[model samples]
Target chain A: MKTKPLILISNDDGITSKGIRTLVELMSELGEVVVVAPDKPQSGMGHAITVNESLRLYKTDVFEDLGVEAYECSGTPADCVKLAKHHVLKDRKPDLVVSGINHGSNISVNVLYSGTMSAAIEAAIEGLPAIGFSLCDYAHNADFSHIRGYVKRIASEALRNGIPKYVALNVNFPAIMQGEIKGIKICRQARARWQENFDERKDPHGRLYYWLVGDFINEDPGQDTDVWALDNGYISIVPCRFDMTCYESFPAISQWEL
Target chain B: MKTKPLILISNDDGITSKGIRTLVELMSELGEVVVVAPDKPQSGMGHAITVNESLRLYKTDVFEDLGVEAYECSGTPADCVKLAKHHVLKDRKPDLVVSGINHGSNISVNVLYSGTMSAAIEAAIEGLPAIGFSLCDYAHNADFSHIRGYVKRIASEALRNGIPKYVALNVNFPAIMQGEIKGIKICRQARARWQENFDERKDPHGRLYYWLVGDFINEDPGQDTDVWALDNGYISIVPCRFDMTCYESFPAISQWEL
Candidate 1:
C-alpha cells in the first residue's frame, strides 16, 4: 500500500470544535493527519498573527485515541498553519492544508472576516493546496452530515489533482438535512454585508458596555453566488486569492495627483 | 472662522508609541482631533474586532494637556473606530479617520497583516474617508519629521476633495532626514512579500518552539510602485479599497464546473 498523504488540519473555532473533529475523522481515512489549531476560538480574526508577544505551542497526545497526531497552538488560525509548516512538519511540507468545518458560513463578505479562510489563504501563499470548510449555522451542535461525503471527495480530488498555487478554495455547506443537500456549486462570493447594530449595556460597575451584533444581508441574490448556492440547498466552492490589488481600477485611480 | 475638520486618530501600536503621538500632533493642526486607540500594541492583527468577548475602553489623560480628546481602547484598531463612531462621538460623524504613523511600512503584502490599514479600511466601509500612515523605519522612536508636511497636505486634500467611497489611502514614508524628503508620489501597490522563515528552538524541557522571522522581498521596482516611491525618498500614497473580489477573473472562474 502507498504511504498516506500528509494532511495538515486547522480551524478558527479552536482545536476542540465539533467541526474539526468531523473533518479529522473524514481525512483520517485519506492520509496521515496532523492537527494544529488555536487554543481558543478566533472566529473573525482575519489574517491575524501573534507578532507582539511570545506564542506558546504545546505538544500533547490529545488525539492518540483518534489514531492521529495533534498539537494545540496558542495563536490565531493563521499562526497555526505557519507553526505547523515550520516546526511540526519540519522534515517535509504537507501535501495539503484544510481549515475549518466552521460553525458559521464564510460565504460572501464574511470571508473578509474569517479566521478559517485566512488560514487557507496563508497556506496557499506558501504554495500549499488549501481548502476552508464552513457551515451556514453558528450553533455549537451544527450538523456536518450533509457535507462529509462532499468534503472527503473534494479534498481527495484536490490532493490528487493539485490546486493552482495562488488559489485556495472556500467551501460552505447549508445547514440542512443530509438528504436535503441538493449538490455542489462552484460560484463567486456574493456581494453581501452584515447590517450592524450594537447592543448597549451597563456593567455591574455602572460603566457602559456594548455588544457587536449584525444580521447577514445578501445584497446579491444572483444564482451565481455562494450565498445562493447554500440557499438553494447546494454546497458552494469559491476559489480565492489574497493579492487584493483591484487591478482593473488602477488606471482610474492612478489619475489622482499627490 | 472655518471649523477645523473633526479627525479621528488611532494606531496599532499602543497609545504611548511615538507613532500615534506624531499622528495626533500632526492632525491637530489640520482638524479637531479625537483619538481612540489600543492601550497595547496590536501589530499583525488584521481586521480583528473585539467580539465573542467583553472589551474595556478607558478614557486616558495621556496628551490631556493638548486639549485633544484622547482615549485608549482595550481592543483592536477596527474596534476603536466602531466604538468611536457609536459612543465617543454621539454628536457628529467624524470628518475623517486616520490611523498610524506606524513604526514600519505597511506597503504591499504587509497591508494584509496590518491593524492600522484595517482601521482605515473599517472607516472606509463605514462610509468615512480614511487614511493609514506609516514610516519605513521600525524603530520605536522612529523620526517622523520628514513626512509631517506631506501628511498634513495629503490629509487636508483628502478632507477637501473627499475619497471614492469604500476606498482609503495608504501612505508610507521613507526613513530619511527631514531635508532629504524629496516629494510625494501617488502609486499602485508594489508586488512584494515576506519570505517566511521560522527559527526553531528547544526549551530546557526539550520541547520545541518557533519564532516567525522573515525578510521582505520586493519584486516590483517600477517608478509607479509604492515601494519604488518610498525608496526614492518620496512619500508613497496608494489608494486602497475594501472589496477583495477580482471581478476580472469572475467571468473565467464562473465557468468552472463540479
Candidate 2:
C-alpha cells in the first residue's frame, strides 16, 4: 500500500454544485483528495482575493463519501487556493491544484473574468501545477459524462509528470453525450468576446434591475484554437500563465522618451 | 480652439475619495474630463465587473465647478469604463481612460488584485490608451502635492502619442514632500506579493469577523523594476497587458502528448 498524492480541489460554483461533485469523484481515484471551495456561487470573479474582509471557512461535508476531507470557504476561488496551501496543508504542498468543472466556458476573453481559472492560476503562482475545467453549458444539468474519463486520465498523467512552473491548463469540454465524445486536443484559447446585452426589469418595489446576457462571438476561425476544438467535439486545453507582460513590445517602448 | 481629448476617469475608490478627485482635477488641465466612478469604495475588487447585479447611474454636480461633466455609477470600476463607453460617451470614444491616484501603491503583485489597474486594463481591452496611478500612502488625505505635474505630463503624452494595442501603464508615485520628486522611469513589474494575514475580530453581536491585513513582501530587488524606481524617489511606470499567456513556453508544451 503506497501513500497517495494529496490533491486539492476547488470550484466557482460553491460546495454543492454537481460539477464539483463529479470532479471530486474522479479525483478520488487519482489521489487523496481535499476540497476547499467557495460557499456561494462566484461566477465571474476574476483573480479576486478576500483582502478587505475576513474569510470564514467551515468544516463541510459536501459529499457523503468515504475517506475525503472538505471545507467550505466564504471567499473567492483565489482565496480558497491561498488558504488551502498556507493554512490547511502546512506539512507538504499538494501534488496538484484542480479548479472547477465550471458551469460555463472560460474560453477566449471569458478567461479574464473567470473565478474557476483564477483559482488554477493562483495555484500556479505558488508553484503548484493546476488545471481549470469547464463544460460549454451554463445549465445546471449540463452533460459532463463525456469528460469524466478524460479528466481522470489528464489528472493522473499530470501528477505522474510535473507541469511547467508558473503555468496552468484551461481545459474546456464540449457538452455532448459520452458516446459522441471526440478525443481531447491541446488547443489555444480562441479570440472571442461576449456581445453585451443587459435586460432591464422592474422590481416589486418599483426598483429597476438588470441581468447580464450575452451571445458569444468567436471571430477566430483558426482550426487550432480552443473554441474550434470544442466546436469540433474535442476537449480544449490551453496553457495559461499569471505573468501578463507582452515582452515582445518591451524593446519598442524602451526607445520612447519618458 | 479644437476640442481637447475626451478623457474618461474613474477609480476603485468612490467618487468622493481624494484619490479620484485629485486624478480628475489634474486630468482637467490636460483634456476634456468625464468621470464615472463608483458611488461607494470598491478596493481589492481585482478586475471585477458588476454583471450579476443591476446598475444605477446618476449625474453628479461635484465636478461642475471645474467645468467637467461627471456621473456616479452604482458598479465596480470596470463597469464605469464600460458604461462610459457604451452609454455615457456614445457619440465619441474616449481619447483616454485614467484610473486612480490610489490611496496606496498598486505596484508588482498588487496590480493583480487591484480594481484601479483593472479599470485601466478594461480600457486597454477596448482599444483606448489608459493609465492607473497610485500613491504609497493609504491615508484618505495623504499629501499629494508632488506628482501632480507628472500625472499631467504622462496623461498628456499618452494622449499625444497612442499606446500599443491591448496595453496600459501602471504608475506609482512615492509618498514624499513636494520637492522630493524625481523623474519617471519605465520599468517592469517586480515579483512581489502580500504575506497573507487575516485579522480576526468580534462584532458587537458576538459574531466573528475578519479584516484583510498583511505586509507586502517584495522578493525581487531588480534595478529596472517599478518597485525599485518608486523606492529611489522616482515615479514608476510599468506597461501592462491583458494577455496572460507565457508564449515562450507554448512550443515546449505543444510537443507534449495531449
Candidate 3:
C-alpha cells in the first residue's frame, strides 16, 4: 500500500490565525500534514532569515486532534520552511510545501514583499513543488471556504504533475465572489507598485516618525497579468522563480563599454 | 556649467558602515550624493518593508566633511529608497540609485535574499537605473581599496550608458586578490543555494534553540555563470529583474488540468 504523502505547511500569519487553521484543515485530508510556522505574524517579511538572532521551535498541539503534527517557530515564514526541512522533518523530505491562505492579496508587485510567497519560493529553491495561496480579503475572519475546492484542485494537479523546474505557483483568490470564481488563470505578474506615502507623526519624545502607507497601483493594465485576472474574478496562478536574472537585458548590458 | 548627476546611495549595512562611507566618498566625486541608509545592519532582510512598526529618519553629520547629504533611516534598504524618492528628495528625482559596496558577496542565488540587491530592485521598479555592489569579504574591516578603481569604472559606465529597461545590476567583487583583478564579466546568475545546517543548542532554562548556518553550494558549473566569474578572479555583473515569473515554465503550467 502506498503511504500517504507528507505535506509540509507554513504561513506568514501565526499558527493560530484562521488562515493557517483553514489551510491545515484542508491539507490534512490530502496528506499527513506537518506544520512548522511562525509563532507570530510575519506579514511583509519577504525572504528574510533570522541570521542575527537565534531561533526557537516548539511543538504545538494546535492540530493535535486533527492528527496533524505541528510546531511553532520563532522566525519568519522563510525560516519556518528552512527549519522544517532541516530539523522538524529530520531526513524525511516533504512531497509538497503549501504556504498561506493569506489574509490579503499577493498579486503583482506584492509578491516581492510577501512572506507568504517567500515561504513557497524557499521550498522551490530546495527543488520542492510548492504553492502559496492568498485571498483578496484582509479581515481576520476572511472567508476561505470559497477557495477550498480550487485550492484542492491546484494542489492535486501539482502533485500529479510536478511543478516545472525552478518554478512555484503563487495562487491568489478573489474575496468570496458572489458568483463562483471564474476558473483559474495562469498569468504573468503585473508590473505594479505601491505609491507610498509616509504618514508623519510626532512621538512622545517630540521627535517625528513615519508610518508606511500606500495605494496599490497596477501600472500594467494588460489582461494577461495576475492583477487583471484577479480583478476579473478568476483565481490567478503565477509561476514564480528564485532566479532574478533578466536574460533579455543581458545582451544590451554585455554591449556596454566596460 | 554642466549639471552634476544626482546619485542616491543606500546599503544593507547601516549608514555608519565603512561600505556606505566608501560609496559616498567615491560617488561624491561623480555627482551630488545623497545617502539614505538603514540605521542598523539589515543582512538577509530581502525586500521587507516596515509596515507594522513606525520609522524614524534623521539628518546625520556622518558625511558632513564629504559634503554629501546623509540621513539615517530606521527601516530596511528598500524603505530607504522609497522614503528617499518620495519624502527626502521631494521634487528632485535621482539620476541613479546605488546600493552597497557590501561587506559580503551577493552572487548567484544570494541576490534573492539580499537587502543590498532589494534596494536596487526597488529603484529598478520605479524605472530608475540602479546597481548593487558587494565584495566577497564579510569582515567589518574588509579591505575595499583594491576595488575602488573598478567600482568607479562600473558606475561611470552605467551613467554614461543607461541600464536596459526593467533591469538592475548585481555586481560582486572577489575579495582583494593578490594579483590585479581580472576584467569584469557580464554573466547569468548561477543556480546556487545555501545548504542549511541548524546548530541546535539548549538554553540555560533547558529549552532548545537553533542558530541559522549554511554553506553556499553552486550547482551550476557553467562558464558564463556569475559564480564561475567571481571564482576565477573576475568581477561579476548580472542583470536582474523584479519579475519573478518563470516565462519558460508558463506553457507547461498552462497545460495543468486545474
**Highest lDDT, which number?**
3
lDDT of 2 by residue, B179-247 (tens): 777777888888776666656678798766555566778788789888899899888888898767555
Runs in model 1 lying further than 4 Å from the true structure: A1-4, A220-223, A248-257, B1-4, B200-208, B219-224, B246-257
Of candidate 1 chain A, the 10-residue stretch with the lowest lDDT total is A245-254
How do all models score by TM-score? 0.91, 0.94, 0.98
Compose the digit string of candidate 1's lDDT tens values, residues A163-237. Answer: 766678898989988888898877888877565666777899999667877677788768988989888999988
Docking class of 3: high
Q: What does candidate 3's lDDT look like per residue over B81-126, in tens digits?
A: 9999989997898888999989999998889789999999999998
Model 3: how far is B196 from its true place, Å? 0.8
- Model 2 DockQ class: medium
Q: What are the runs in model 2 whose C-alpha is more than 4 Å off?
A: A201-209, A219-221, A255-257, B200-209
Task: Specify the highest-DockQ model's number.
Answer: 3
Ranked by DockQ, the better of candidates 1 and 2 is 2
TM-score of 2: 0.94
Runs in model 3 deviating more than 4 A are none
lDDT of 3 at B234: 93
Q: What TM value does model 3 have?
A: 0.98
